[model samples]
Target: MSTTPLPLSALAAPIERGTAAYRRANFALFLAGCSTFSLLYCVQPLLPEFARDFGLAPAVSSLALSLTTAALALAIFIAGALSQQVSRRRLMFASMALAAACNLLAAIAPDWTSLLLARTIEGAMLGGVPAVAMAYLAEEMDPRHLSGAMGLYVAGTAFGGMMGRVGMGVLVEIGSWRSAMAAIGAFGLIAAIGFAALLPPSRRFAPRRGFVARHHLDAWRAHLAHPGLLRLFAIGFVLTSVFVALFNYVGFRLAGAPYDLGPAGISLIFLAYVFGMFSSPFGGRLADRFGGRAPLIGGIAIMTAGAVVTLAAWLPLIVLGICLITIGFFVAHSVASAWVGRLARADKGHASSLYLLFYYFGSSVTGVIGGWAWQHGGWSGEVALTASLALAGIVLAIRIEDPRQPDRSDA
Candidate 1:
């Protein structure tokens, strides 16, 4: 990848701040973002079905989702670095196209191992989008509208997640899991084409001179050295891990426990994500008004309260708890993601990739640990584990000084 800086002025006009073409570009990008994540996570609800069909354990089935994220995290750094040489629009277009194909292949896999292999590759391909999208936005969108645009993009992600899980569950009831997966892949293919068509050619992206080993290393070091960035990264890990863990096993608890429910019934739980879709943008606005610190701390506090609510045996209380958790997670995620942009002086793509790497690592690791908690301690134990993680997030939030402080660099 070349290091030559693209003409910053050409791409500097925020898309959201520009003419009608820019607004169309932003909307198209939002759709692309939603489709990418929706396809990636559509397999989640089908995990239990995979376990039963393949005669595997819960942990083994989870690898279908976990392996994809694991591969995605590892691939993000490489993809981000590579995009320095490639056009952002072209890279993202190719990524969604390839990921869609991978999903189709996974849908027809004859066995569990083959399915996992396809999912891993899908994850790797999907890495291109998140690793580059933010930097693209920062380069192109007007500075005044950048945060709001990013917030909308984050909300799109939340919507995609809900649609993926809930749509899969509903579709699986109508057809087979394979069909559900295929449908999502088809949707992704359409979205990819739309994204390519709508995204204007980059005026600001200049090819990097070439890949330098030191550049990558320096970028990582600089990102890690910032106290605010480091704290945000840690929070990203814990926040996502705790969130994934809670959702991974909540269905199991509901399906088997005092509130016995079927797959369809379990699917309804994802409706809580609607709250997340709203919360993300709302959180971003709050961050703008009150600074990131208040939303970060307040979100974690809500999450802790939600985790405790889940401890109750009552079904209604459980639903309310899940809603609270959903709201908290989105608020926290929106704040932290935007904070990364504000914190990094350069190599914004690399900084975003590092944040997501930690984000998904938490998903892969604590997601599994959460399963262990489920098996041994049951729902109560899982709640305890989630609460502990949220508390850690709260502590991290408390330690994050204001980004406007003298020591912090204003990007």
Candidate 2:
């Protein structure tokens, strides 16, 4: 494939369903989502490995991911603004490339502190991906088919998240966590190059060309002031908080108590994300027909039930619970993220950024809170925390006004 970007004339018009541009754009984003999320989350299954090797406390070990998410949350806010002045495709590609290199550095780090630093930087690098990606889909894809296109992107993330955890588990089993990290990093670098070549240059996005502090601050203020957007932002926050919190501590439960599973065994558990991979696109299709309200609430309801089901002592029930969580989370996410594009009248990048700002902030915060819940209250306590947040997500989703213009995020 030629490295030269697609000319503006090629993609100036909105990408319609079944068109070559639509297929190319979606596939490129699929790669982008796969690389970005796999790099971000590959360490999730490695939490145990960190504890065993570093002789750290459970909460302390979680800082590997929590700190990265924390940095990512803040960086997302900055990157949203930065995207205004840069090429969305180039920014995303660079972010992916640098982040992959950072992981390689992390793979060789000699101490816990060094690893944490590398991960944090990796998080910062990833900030460019999500918000920009959402903006890109919202801009380039035909408005009539936004739901389906966004669904494909979310499905990519689902697959990436799955492989990140699942692949890390398998890799660490065959070699070591260090080698696993290096391998995923190398894959991300390749994906970055591919993404840079495949993603059509922006036609809808009018670059601002400089740091217009006043404009950015105003955009943030406007998004914050919009009641509907705030509801979606809250929904984004609750979604990740509950999801990350549960997955964060579940490893300890599987490692100890009733089930004593090794990295490979526990990794098989993350195969649940396959459910997520399917649910996301289905959810998007649902949104296109029904509207955002039904699916958003429905997804959250499923998540709440899944959290409760995990309380069961049976092994099958626990795996079923994880699958339900994965399904519900992706559905809710696909709906909510697409809805963000619908509701934004302008400055789409800023709007997407604000939404993800809340999304990742929740992930970072809950990782620690979930740790405390696990340490003090065990799996039941973790369930209590997730279930409550999920319930709140339902309430917020209910309050959000589904925009009729662009379409619903309802599947």
Candidate 1 RMSD to the correct structure: 3.3
Candidate 2 lDDT score relative to the true structure: 0.87
- Weakest ten-residue segment in model 2 by summed lDDT: 1-10
Listed in order, each prediction's TM-score against the native is: 0.90, 0.91
Report every candidate's CA lDDT: 0.83, 0.87
lDDT of 1 by residue, 51-150 (tens): 9999999879988987888788888878878877778889999999999999999999999989999999999999999868777766666544555556
Best-fitting candidate, scored by lDDT? 2
lDDT by residue (1-411, candidate 2, tens digit) is: 112234445547888878888888999999989988898889887887899999998778878887787788888899988887889999999999999999999999999999999999999999999999999998887766787788889999988988888888889879999999999999999999988888888887767655768888998999999999999999999999989898877877998866988667777877888888789989888887788889899999999999999999898999999989989999999989989988887778899999998898788778779989999999999999999999988888888887584344422
Candidate 2, residue 80: how far the Cα is off, in Å: 0.4
Error of 1 at 110 (Å): 3.9
